[model samples]
Target chain A: MANFPENIVPSEMKNFRISIDDFIEAYNKGEAELVDIRVPMETKVWQVNFGLKIPANELPKRLDELPKDKLIAVACPHTDRSNMARVYLAEQGFNVKYLVGGLLGLMERLKGGMAKDINL
Target chain B: MKEISFDDYLKSFDYDERKAMKIKLNEMLKLYEEGKAEIIDIRFKDEYEAWHLGFGKNIPLNELPNRIDELDKNKTIVTVCPHYDRAEIARLFLKLKGFNARYLTDGLLGTVDYLRGDKARDYIAKIKGES
Candidate 1:
């Protein structure tokens, strides 16, 4: 029921998108990993503490850096870039899910008095 | 007027005792990050849908006993609610049922207040003695 960005075309991949709740559950259980595909400037402003940064443009060249042990939740400022990464990663056989609303949604949820990030 | 009893005066003290039963936010976070504990939100489905901590399972307070089996027996459970009251009750029940558990003393609202006041880093630093 989430409103994904209009720019993203739906994919036929098995690993698709994840809810904030699911992301949280997987993260807390240590069964999930986060990959932020936003560029350096955007990520520098703020980013989830536990997420690994792999700029979208560089992901193909750096895909080997992603962990094979856990499910990957790809995120960007919005769903645009992460969705692309999700499709690409899925094609590459990495178990992946795009963060449904991405980092902007996370910031909104945080600002709206949902839960604060686990640690600074 | 109806009598104002000593029990009324002792009520505040009792509340403090309950507060003492709560797990410190930072300590809970550390335990969670280390995979030593699990955070469980005990609010109703709608309330949970509205907002909740990023890391937790939503098992409404009323649905808990039925779903107790879903929780891990070995890990410490941290129960959460809008305020500490419901979570405390859930913690007590879980404890009686033989699960390792604790309540978030001040609950989700307290966490919001802490964030609004910008005390998160300071509190964590203080707890770790980095401040």
Candidate 2:
């Protein structure tokens, strides 16, 4: 039988969640990648100018497009779907984290005239 | 889990713009009040405690696999969160589990905005009448 990986440990789980501020910092430094996991309809309504747009359902097949070296931050409007995506990516041997509070929080942070603070 | 694929989800998006798989807030309220639909708030327990629509059962996304029996197959399950992202994910899962499910497109935040004044009263009155 083929050997499958075990579940992520409790201690390692803490590292799996990254705050938006931290994500922004890493993202600007080109050390992190954001994956918007929201569906096409939702993205059509509103979307960030940057970030790879792969819906959560499509992640399993579109894994090749993602970079293995950078820290991947999966985000939805909130953390739930991103967390699920993070787990899936982690299992597939990628360094990934669910964006804490997701893209909604990032939008709030980047709202108004402050949008230029984020380099990417 | 069932053998549903990403193509199935993509098909929903590609064909007819997903009008058949999504529910607006007004339609959800009407169907739920009439007992033809059930709302499933698929947020974390903390998020639900922070704010909720006061109807439907709270089933966190991760806990869904364990609590599949709680969902009624007879009624249309409308999965919801603040926005449609998590709700759509839950909807897809529920659909795969052999339940008639749809994502709340207008969203819980939109529903809250919509339920103020007379609209809220009438909806609550219907729920009270049923109970």
Candidate 3:
């Protein structure tokens, strides 16, 4: 693994937070790539439309499979796991960002009526 | 083989960024009730079928990719395993692949509690009696 820039540390991760609305907007506009770090099974139960599935444990070996140049957004059931993956990807020098509220956060936003018309 | 330090083993599993979104348990409950979120039982098929949360959808970790298309991308997803570790690993993988996902912090049984509401305790008691 490579050393991360001081700004990239998750302790300093605030700069990378992306809200559910922004994520959905980007996805809709095809401006960002969504990466789901959950295992395959959970994804089969529910997931974001068009989001890619790549388990965290398998990410290291499968690094080559991802598009190196795209702006990738990572998400998990919560933020912690995805944060770790974000840190790892950042360390590996990939252009990556993580969802701020995770799926739960997104659901919360939707339920709160903040982005009801977004269609997830 | 020589022993490896826990720290070293942990290091081997290290990834680059560490950003995370914070969500409370109460919020998760509301999502479940609204039908926007699905709790997944990420255990082997046999173990999942033998016993699991009433609402948990069984999806073995290994078979996730091929079955990915079956899920509704618009919904929230929570994964559960015997322990939270496997579920966490699964969550990470799905995030990298760009799926909206999360894992039940309480593991499999915890998710049952969240799903069952106040009935969780009674459910556990009944199971204990049956066993």
The predictions' CA RMSDs to the true structure, in order, are 21.2, 6.1, 15.6
The TM-score obtained by model 2 is 0.62
Candidate 1 chain B, run of 10 with poorest lDDT: B1-10
Clashing pairs in 2: none
Estimate TM-scores for all models: 0.40, 0.62, 0.43
True contacts kept of 3: 0.04
- The DockQ value obtained for model 3 is 0.03
Off by over 4 Å in 3: A5-12, A108-120, B1-131
Better of 1 and 3 by lDDT: 1
RMSD of 1: 21.2
Better of 1 and 2 by lDDT: 2
On residues A1-120, what C-alpha lDDT tens digit does candidate 1 reach at each position? 111111222133224678767887787778888899877777788867777998766676787899888999998776645655675576577989888768878667666446654333
User: How do the residues A1-120 of candidate 3 rate in per-residue lDDT, one tens digit apiece?
Assistant: 121221222244345557777887876666777788877677789866666788876787777877676767888877667766776777677887788878777667665556554543
Stretches of model 2 off by over 4 angstroms after superposition? A1-21, A35-59, A74-93, A97-120, B1-3, B6-21, B43-54, B82-86, B128-131
Q: What lDDT tens digits, residue by residue, belong to model 3 across residues B29-119?
A: 5676666776666676677768876554777766666566666677767766765545654565455445567776666655554556556
Best by TM-score: 2
The alpha-carbon lDDT assigned to residue A71 of candidate 1 equals 91
The better candidate by DockQ, 1 or 3, is 3
